[model samples]
Target: MVSGSNGDGVRVPSASFSRLSATNVLFGWTWPQLAVGGVGLVLLVIGGAAGFNLPVMLVGVLVMAYGLVRFQGLSLLAWTYVWFTWRSRLREGSNVWSSSPLETGRTVGVLGVWSQVEDRAQVVEGESVDVVGTPWRDACYLYDPDKRQATAVLTLKVEEWSLSTNARKRDRAMALNNLTMTLASTPGVVELKETSLLMPTSAPVPPDLDDPDMPSWARGDLAELWAMPEIATPLANVSWVSVSVNVDRLSTRSRNMDRLTERNRVGVLLGDIVQNVVAPALVECGGQHGSIRWCSVDELRDMIRCVSDPAHASSQRKVRRGEPTLSYCEESADGEYVTLESCVARSWWVTQWPDRPVPAGWTRDILQGDRMIALTHIWRPLSMAESEKDLANKQSSMLQRSRLADQKRLSRDERRERREQAQREAEQDANWPDTDHQGYITLFAPDKSRLDDLERGLRMETGKYHLTLNGLTGQQRKALATVLPLGV
Candidate 1:
């Protein structure tokens, strides 16, 4: 975190996560680019050694061009991977998933058996959050037999920070940073996911209109104000944090145990981590005392149901474990968005973060809007050895880049990156674990036209902070998986 006094002399804490790696693996080229360019160079050298054959040299030039050219921030080879992946999905019919309606003509409302995604061993594919077991009351986990990992979801109710004093904000930020450090030091924690779900809620109870002295005109106007659409659909934001532990990483003894025994072991370990590490750290970070708890089996099911089918989000309906969460999900005919039952959804990759330092709560404006949206941050912690190696590579890359450019001048982006790297170095010196994170934004609408309008407005709003949102086309389903509170 970067803490400093603002123009008003209020000390506020701000932060910017590291973007995609800019370090060069070789001569200012990433691994993929370097490999492609190296092959081309080899071809050119062979042609030169063979008396400069024109055809061979031409092929070499074309290969080099292919390596250097980029389209939509991806090279030709990278695009090829995307194309094949999408094509395979199409062939496998993975893009469209529909559940047959029951006798009552209603589809399942909670995730359950789906033969299409089920493997021979009955494991659900692609970030499925199906709960495999609830070892005890108020403690449950989503287990992946293949990965031998179990993830526990916890509901976190943090203290409100809006309009809080500067000291409180600073303290909150520091406490959060401390929690991060604690997580980094803890072993067997493979990933940490924080998700915020913003939904439209029913209007709150209005003041009693039975006043004896109230004039008719005043009462009429007050009733109209309270009945406004925005007021009726007030925004409600819910936050969830999921921690994934590698069962095998925790105990090798599980390798010889049966699946049930292994799951039980994982459950016990997860409970311990939540009670000892996560719960305490969250409490210290201004979270309400006793407000953090592991989701029971039913709560987890309902959470997934609500996220998958937002129309049911405000209904407070009970979701059974044996029903599918989504009824009918398919990519739009234009491939611009996805339709999940009644809601039209679109997702974006947060390609850029604000270059200028902003407060830790800078996202309030975007998140507190009337529209329903979900912003997810997935963090993968780096071990100390891995952190040192990355830092060394970044330093080397920057030094080489400077040498290649004019000594006295640097580009604006270069300067900003240099400054950011300096801060990272300081963080490392302070034993703060380096983390790689990806940000995703998913927006929901009742229809395609509304979704389009929301997208346009959000683009403008995010641009104010120099943020970049790249629409995830042809991959909406996969991108949506990351933003869901499933620890994807």
Candidate 2:
């Protein structure tokens, strides 16, 4: 990083970061500026040596300087990861001030077809581009004609990531269905008067890989690779805005295949074109060709949090005369993703209804455990085994409560009165003090080295008995705490 006293006073700094932490790092440099700067510097230096043109080398020195400037401060880099909250399908865009903001007079229109492009103007710089609803991450192509240097920021506001084959098929089928109806209703456009479906009669028999007469019993070896997902070559040209990628064959050999489900196979494509392509090309186009999109600092912060923990949301809010509030909560898993679902009402969500919004000052259910008390929090899907276990525990708890109810034969109103009366008595009892004192158990060790082994043995024993425990102090009491568990 360099700070020239004669140049603009923008701060320049540098530091190292892990490789994965460095991808979203946004910075800009024009190839022309760098190339010109390089040539000028070399010519000026050589000219100085050869005695021809000192100014050429000086100009080259100025142009040759380029850098990857960190967009937002790296300290807050943790929240910028937004694969959550925002789905992978939604478009994302952001407004980045270049060395200068775009003046108001400029007007720009963007088109998708590559034939219309006139010059090499990148969109992420100068003015903003795309519709207001277009997300930051979905910046396919942006256009800003104003020239004075500015930044074309890449915003990542991911939308949906449900890219499974079933999802795609359903999406395509829905589109097809809508098209069918639209064509039938309207007369002007091409018509889908009729429709039919077809299915493959049989799986393609793969070529035998070994000796022709190898027994069918041993033929399993030949079918191994043949059973892999087949790749289909691209059929038509897709003219996407800003980016033009020729789609190749779609292959299923990329990811997990063992746990494959119907209506889908794992993702197959020519990289993340539908989502990651497009708008980025606008930024790359530069000049009047590019467009810009930006969210407020506060919205960007919330967006970052949402993206980082898609499953959990960290919200920012302000009330009329109050300090801004930051609240957090986890999103419910999609029903289709409930792998270990149990047929019981013991689900955390089932027990604690979600239809109602959470009240203020009540974050226990949101951040902590959703159980009766939340001391520790874990965000993970409940597998069927765990769901089953929860069901059993809930039934047992219900049985205990049922027994208590049965023991007191009362109507609904009477039961309520009785429960209230019992609660009051329990409260009264809690207020009363008890005088029973606990005695300490002490084990005297002949050698200090032996105490470590004794403590370890006692700790293991306590765990076996499901005994409550805490750290022990005083050598005598500590020794006793460990030894007593062994006996119990």
Identify the leading candidate in terms of lDDT. 1
**C-alpha positional error of residue 186 in candidate 2 after TM-score superposition, expressed in Å:** 44
Candidate 2: where is the Cα deviation over 4 Å?
Answer: 1-37, 49-54, 66-488
Candidate 2: C-alpha lDDT = 0.26
- Provide the overall lDDT of each model, using Cα atoms, as 2-decimal numbers: 0.71, 0.26
Task: Name the top TM-score candidate.
Answer: 1
lDDT by residue (57-122, candidate 1, tens digit) is: 889988987775565446677777777877777787777887765523443432332333222112
Residue 208 Cα positional deviation in candidate 1, in Å, after optimal superposition: 9.1
Model 1 scores worst on lDDT over the 10 consecutive residues at 118-127
What's model 1's TM-score?
Answer: 0.86
Candidate 2 lDDT over 55-115, as tens digits, reads 7656645444422223322221221333322232123211110111241222121211111
- How many clashes show up in model 1? 4
**Model 2: lDDT of residue 251:** 33
RMSD each, Å: 4.5, 37.1
